[model samples]
Target: MSSSGLVQIDGLSPIRKEDRKTSKVMLLFPPEWVPTAPYLALPALTSVLREAGHTVVQRDINIEMYDHFFTMEFLIWVKGRLGMQLKPLQDKEKAGRLTEQEAAQKAVLEEAYAVDVFDLAQRSEDAKLIVRGERFYDAEKLERALNTFREAMQYISAAYYPASLVFYPMESNLGYRPGVSKEVFACLDDEQVNVYRDICNQLVLPSVSKEKPTVIGISIGTQMQLMAGLTFCKMIKESFPDIHVVVGGNVVTRLQEEWAKHERFFTEVFDAAILYEGEHALLWYIEAVNGQRPMESVPNLMYHASGAVQQSKEVYTEKTAALPLPDFEGLPLDHYFVPERIIPYLATRGCYWGRCTFCDHGQGYFDQYRGMTAQHVVEQVTALRDKYQCRHFLFSDESYPPALFKKVSQLLVDRNVGIKWTTLIRFEETLQDQAVWDLAAKAGCCTLYYGMESANERVLNLMDKHAKKSVIQNNLHQAAKAGIWNHVMAFYGFPGETRDEALETRQFVIENQPVIHSVELFYFVAYRHTPMVRNPDKFGITIHKQEEYDLPLDYYYTLNEPVGISCLDAMQLCEEFYKNDFSPWAVRVNSREHVFLYISKFGTNKLPQIYAATKDGATTAEGVSGLVTWPMAIGEGDEGKEGMSRVVSHGVG
Candidate 1:
């Protein structure tokens, strides 16, 4: 019977047909958020569900959908559809060079982000300049991000969530995305809608026969989709009224604090909405609906049944330490777009240093921090390697707990998990020790994402990111010495940022070129749930009155600082840096404008944007550093957003 029926997928293997004979459940990944891939989300949900003894199935609509979109024939058609925008990418070698006609258009697109018009730090007062007209958008670069992403998808092959994909589908937050191009919009949208409809049909009507699911648990993952959640619930109800539809995820919790009382506002949609984590709430509700319980008293569940919506009490305030690891046994690990199975994990919840003004890291009403024991960490990886037979894992932490990491990493080395992993890490107390590094690398952690924001101290003081440049630099250096591939995340356009500081940032990149993977940029955007959302008026940051959307929305307003520049001015600076102004430029002195060239490459899908990791006189290397920059754009007449953390290089220029 070794290959006969199904297998139980606990921490290592999920519950497959071999293990369960009665029930079936499917975890649906709505499209658009490539960043929040299904690999990260599925494990968390499934682990908890399995803990409750339920059989689970995962349907990654994004991958299945993309397979239907980007084909070998389609890339060329998309490039042609994008026309001028894609001309630069056809030949990677000629990325930066432009024809006069193309140059003129590029100039216009580059200039669109040239003026810091929001008046942060009074730059607009000193210089009356505002980027306008054709200069308002970087159509070509935007096109590059899209087409490259379309092309990159051929390479990345990630499992994505459709909720946001159905809505904003583009990675608009960071430098990682294909810039938003208007030309690709029409064709992509048509394809996206077509894909969504197709998948929904597949869900309702699989080609072969299967039992109707006992319950449908729809996740409202992002807060931006409150209305979409309503509409989605209504649609599901209309389609699958025979089955119970239970709603969950962080989105519902946030809504409860604001609009759960407005049940009349969302009638025929959600049968029950869990405000907090879905573990216990889901188990009780499922059984109650199964007629096993006479009357349901499920904690943290909301329902608009019997004509009125009823609210429930909070479940667990603190996260449990002995968390069940994601069961990946029957799940499609190979389906993800990675070199190998990068099994992503979570070590903790809520950032340790949570005082940053603009960030909502510690905003979950129950934002209590809980990390797993080192023993548990080792056990899970050991089990995964024993069962799934994989070597790579990725940690999906906002900022993974350093202590937990220290112990867990050490334990992995001792236990010989025989796996390698990567994580999103922070500076400060975490990066100070050497044991953590030695243990981490040996334990299979080969990469670290360090958010090093700025090289300037004044900026650091303003941002309140206690991460000192010296400490980060040394840690990044040491990590490299230990043979860890490091990624440093940085940013531009703060409240008090000067072209001089930007130059210094580029200089830092040049100096520290050897011990990094690549420099990344994050435009400061005010996130919801933080203190900034509490009083944007006090901060001069006009808050965005959020509107209902089918996807994620930037609700917090972001402009420039108080003294010299406007938000638009800072935005202009960002545009320039994004276009021509390059970081890690000092290393490749000859290729100083490679960033601009890289932009063109993306536009043309010709050359790859090169990152400088190590420097050799005239050349720069490639990799990541530990640079993390918080935003300063709140709004004009604003004090600016949180200047959290931005790490720069020490000696390149």
Candidate 2:
């Protein structure tokens, strides 16, 4: 080992900086993310790595897993696996020693066995064709295709009993809680319930073997992907002991401190982890591996060295303008569920308005805000548009700053980029101008998702989101008038918010239904890194922490004086709103990508065909009780509707 504690190969010799060896890299995007578009992380990191003379292959394993799940070959394999599981369970039951869990597994296996895998496989294959071709424009056929995917997921879920895997809003669970590190580690090695192990064996291992990459990086952006990402990492490490494995992304950044404490993760799972902005850090890490520099010189890195986990002394943030345009050359763009490819673009590094007490998205960045100029954004976006032959774009920024939003809108119109796009934004008084909305629409702004946490002025101010009610209403009205679909995201129970204040938010959404195209209502969560959680007493709430949940990102809480809505009250209110008042927002096509395509095709947000059909087969504009569609129906748990698409707006400012 070198003095910096990096492992060195026997035969390879260290080269000078000017003659740096080309590192072979395999970048994997793990499962449980939306399969509509390629995530920006892989491409973003790939561009930087390739720019530094590295050979990089980026794989969207999430989309690939979904694609493989719908194939006849995979479905038949799942049937065999299920049968093998059922055989052992049957023997145990016949011997009169079956446990309740085993019996339940047997039941699931039997039901799945009865599912005629041949017929389902054919339908599933047909579903793939429907989504990729012009047939996707037909709403009925599209809905059937989506249902076919869900059915395939159910069939696959049976092989891993107790694991509920779904297609679009990726709410898969492996019967193991992710917040508990013990459960996470146990789930990694679980043969029966961890579907990702099979996924890693079938999909990931083959690619790694063929490429023989010296370094592999897995991006775990959300909690949903943590298990799968780690599964791939652990499997890759075990199978190819020589290849270096590293994990990064927003979720990894949030859990860096927790990971430092878990030496096993560093020693057994991955060789290292890149935190915060990973472009420069990963490049330097690859250099360290190649022996061009010491490992200790790589910024934002945490690695096991000399019997301990050592973090780099320095931190680095990307200069937004200096970065190259994201390269999507190797991704399977045609295989996404949508017919036309929607490229994800990021114009900013972090949120400009980073004062929301309930938000922890800012934790993902070291330097809170670093953005590209309007001209730079337009240049890169247009370049990507022409290169990919894709017209639809998803601006994947935490929140587009108002000045940049206005300037980019003007530039796109003046430059005639002609690409339909959508992004997450905060309702601001600066965006109240009708002319600005018109310009944005003319520049191909198909949709705008707003994080309108609450319409009650007091609650909004308390959340540190001082958006005025009038300004929010005006922004919605103007955006709607400009033919842009407005998706309003609000929640109940922010610390001391009273029942009437929560109702005021509901009333605002109901009263503004004409302008509010769609809605996602949720209950409050005191994320571990949020301002409220960091200083709970100041917010008049007490956070409850349990020792078992060592890797928790959020916590359960209670109001100190009970003067406001309790956690249960917020959840119940959310459930009641969806039960009684979600009809207007409930659409036949619930995916944001699907809605974006519809709006782009029809040139308007008033998509009557996309709304939920009445019993008589006609679409209705009036509110109807108990009429819920694919994802608008809130679940019974705290993981209420996170939105239609995870890629579009999960952690938006």
Candidate 3:
């Protein structure tokens, strides 16, 4: 870095002077989600191309769209849409078509419009202030600000647009389920209500026009991004027909088989769809586009040709493990949602334990497990800290390699890396090691998310988790005692799961309220391509599909054999249980912003106290599944030591 503290990448070997003269590749991450942190895929891909002597320009339109849309000026545009909805009621009242009760409700809504909700146009400066951290951290103020924001967004969604406009839990008509191209194409044609199209014109087109890149890659990681991404492709193809539009990510990988059936969709929208670990596929696809290689040589790429989808041969390479460290040089780091920029680094690809029946993770392109060496991870961390002046990281892995992270923790401790990081992990026996947990905490591990899945041992075994109820508890206890926050992810509505078993899972969470800082209870999603979906009979369920072509969509209907809990019943029960019984600190599932804010304010150790006070106000457990024996204090004390020792000594077999 220069003396100005600006990031300087001129010395990097990957960025050669001649590469700037080569074809310019623009990688874009679309908008309408949490503005915190650029998704790691773009940076990882950028590194791959730059290392191969390619000029790449990476831009995050997600943050840019947030900056443009979350202004007071935009409030006036929203109010106009809300007014259009209210105009019908006014006309009805003018024509005497409203009854007394209906008039009263109409008047109430008018009053809301006449009040400060409509005055948001004047609060534009305050909106900026609130988002800029004047009111972001304070729970009460943040709630009010978000309520106002949500009210405006919901009104816009109801009045003009057709998308779930929220900071988290995004959904849209352009759904992520496979074979939704026809439906999404209809959305693309809706110019009147399609705010996404407007966004692309306002934000995406200008940049593309300026750079004039030969290849444009869009990363769609979730169902929420599907609509925006497809619209982006459509708009780009319509305006700049020659730019090769490539779309890929985890979601595309999931939909590859079904998407191939709709060849016209690609013919109209994108040039190709790259699958799996997209680094190799994208590089080869770019090369093929540049005439450096034949189209047939490109691996893992699918495109339309001769009115049919043409697919390249599947490529296998350990390139992800050996690729240059992800380059975040061009992203707008300071504009992310969080106070500290959390760079996502991948330590492994695919799951270390890939036996979960309901999971499609580590399948297809990611079937083989690969992990970067511990020394490589250490070097990457040191380089990132020095280059970006960043101290927070979120490890982007299916499940961080347990043995790999152990070595990383030791290296970070020895080198005094001083970087706070978090990642998802399974309930493995290594977590029961007190020394391991302590070393992780010393190396700045703040939170460890465990996929508890279910509290019932039968349900867990049925899912092939290979973890017992007792082991989950012990790991949580040891992690907490070692000064790391424990986030438990509980899922219900599994095949053949009884109502009693679901309730038992809820009860287990209620009992372990002290050591557990947060819980994310989820209803089971029967993803396609998983063992459970492929062979429902093996799990004692019947999948009733309309067609027999093995195409997977997000939602499915199934008959539970011998009267197991239905998905609806499970969802309703979980909703009621969480609303009535779960601790207030335990946020609703997928509320990423709330989790970050909670940790940012209280710190990880105090999370149990924060949540425990909400329900019965107990920081210590009274017989918590034989896992935690005592309450853990922030500093090293006798109680904390005893709790750690007990957890370590009773490690689950």
Top lDDT: which candidate number?
A: 2
TM-score of candidate 3 versus the correct structure, residues matched by position: 0.83
Residue 61's C-alpha lDDT in candidate 1? 51
lDDT, ranked from best to worst:
2, 3, 1
Q: Show where candidate 3 strays beyond 4 Å.
A: 1-21, 80-136, 158-164, 171-179, 547-551, 586-603, 608-653
The sequence of per-residue lDDT tens digits that candidate 1 reaches over residues 1-653 is 11312121111122343543334565554443332124345556667667767777655554444443433343333333334443453343277556665555444323322322232213211111111122112333333333333333322111111112321132222111111122212222333222333444544336112646777666655422233334444556667676666676554554464445455434555567765555545656665675554223555667765667766543443244655666665555554432244455555665555555555534333545556677876777677667777665555555666777788777887776667666666766556677668777777666666656667766655556667778878888777776676666565544456667756765676588677644555555655555655766645566656343212223636542465344566566655654443444322211111222222223321122233333443322222211211122321100011222111100000
Writing each residue's lDDT as its tens digit, candidate 2 over 1-653 gives 33334332211233455887898999999998777888888898999889878999999999999999999999999999988989989999999999998888899899999999999999999999998889988877887888888889998999988889988666788989999999999999999889999999999999999999989999887788899999999999999999999998878888888998899999889999988778878888898898778898787789999999988756677778988999999999999989999998888876788787887777777666788999999999999999999999998777789999999999999998899999888898898889999999999999988888888999888988899999999999999999999988878888889999999999999999989988888788888878888899899999999999999878888889968999899889998887778777777575788889989998998877677677987544344211123223211111112222253542210
Compose the digit string of candidate 3's lDDT tens values, residues 510-562.
88877777665667766666777778878876766655433344446576566
Model 1 lDDT, residue 359, Cα: 58
Task: Kindly provide the TM-score of model 2 when superposed on the true structure, using C-alpha atoms.
Answer: 0.93
Q: Which number leads on TM-score? A: 2
TM-score of each: 0.66, 0.93, 0.83
Candidate 1 global lDDT:
0.47
